[model samples]
Target: MTMVSNEYGKIITIEQAVEMIDDGCSLMVGGFGGIGSPPSLLQAIIDKGVQQITLICNDTAFPHIGVGPLVAQGRIKKAVVSHIGSNPIAGQLLHEGKMEVEFSPQGILIERIRAGGAGLGGILVDIGVGHEWLAKGKPTVDIDGNRYLLERPLTADISLVYAKKADPFGNLIYDKSARNTNPLVAMAGRITIAEVEEIVPLGELDPEEIVTPGIFVTYIVQSNGVDWKWIWE
Candidate 1:
């Protein structure tokens, strides 16, 4: 693994952090209505002008928040999300054929990531048995002479998650309601990148509080705070 550590392990810059992200890759972003987005890192990507991304997120919040800015900028070519009802830009993109939208059920979306992280080839779920938009593959496997629909693995090139604190070794601690889909997404990606408000020394955190271990994390970026309004309150 290509792990970079500074003298104090705190010199990781936004540019250095997001440099690993490449265009035309499948990405999963962790945040609910932009509440936990890594603002500095996301802005860096916007500033860098990367394009042709397939984003997997919970909800495409209104323009300028969550995945909305990326979608509005035309950087994201496709999105697999739970809900796109909150963003007008998303609807416009879909209507204009500027973006491809795949709306998965909220619950199955979580399982898809979790299954990928666990090294499973895929998961069998009953969320979208007859849906058209999100359902494309018809995989049948017989279990005890019964048939079941298969939900394939959703592996991402990169997963961007926001956390309250992370140790230099990459252990993560998400604050309160900030833990959305981040925990599972952290492991589902080939390269998991985390943006946190604080990055501390290793062994400084209680083992019980570590939601994600260093093995699953590839990079750590320091985030001042998310740019969107908190909705979980």
Candidate 2:
């Protein structure tokens, strides 16, 4: 069994943060690909060798980017994602029957995650009503003669996020495009950990600039910044 620190403060080491994730746990990762992904945290989890992760993310990214290494190493047992086109490994795993992938329309996927965080049972959408795969196994209802599929909420056992800056209390502000899906992902996890490039003192961050309030963050880890070369290759 892994020994996790019992310290009460939200600031923790990357190693300590990854310990909270066990094998077979559901993980929500915030990123469009490699851009906003928490690289150091993800690498730490890979080093720990926790397997059978259920990953929820926007995409699988490239083989060397974002959550791609996890998929390449067969760490992921299932994925709930918008697409896997960017990551050939993920597509291969799906085609070879080694992994299960649940495809959701991009907009609806994020909405489901938001609904999860907001404590809603689910949201109704008409986007996939006639589609064979998207409509499968989902219940539907008609309101005012318009039919909609019930897209259930999505929540994870743990969530990993990246931020541009963070305070001791865990208030976060993200970099431009890197902010994608992170705010919503932060709210939907039972335990949300943020990997930040810089940690500032409390009140140093302008309130107007804070995108994710400290209330949603459970832990903060200092980032060992990503290698852009690997992501660009």
Q: Number of the top candidate by lDDT?
A: 2
lDDT of each: 0.80, 0.92
Tens-digit lDDT track for model 1 on 104-179? 7788788888888998988776555566643566576667866566877677998988899888878899988788
Give a tens-digit lDDT track for model 2, residues 77-104. Answer: 9999999999998999999999999999
TM-score of each: 0.88, 0.95
Model 2 regions lying over 4 Å from their true place: 1-8
TM-score computed on alpha carbons, candidate 2: 0.95
Q: What stretches of model 1 exceed 4 Å from their correct place?
A: 1-11, 130-135, 144-146, 227-233
RMSD (Cα, Å) of model 2: 4.2
Q: Model 2: how far is 166 from its true place, Å?
A: 0.6
Clashing pairs in 1: none
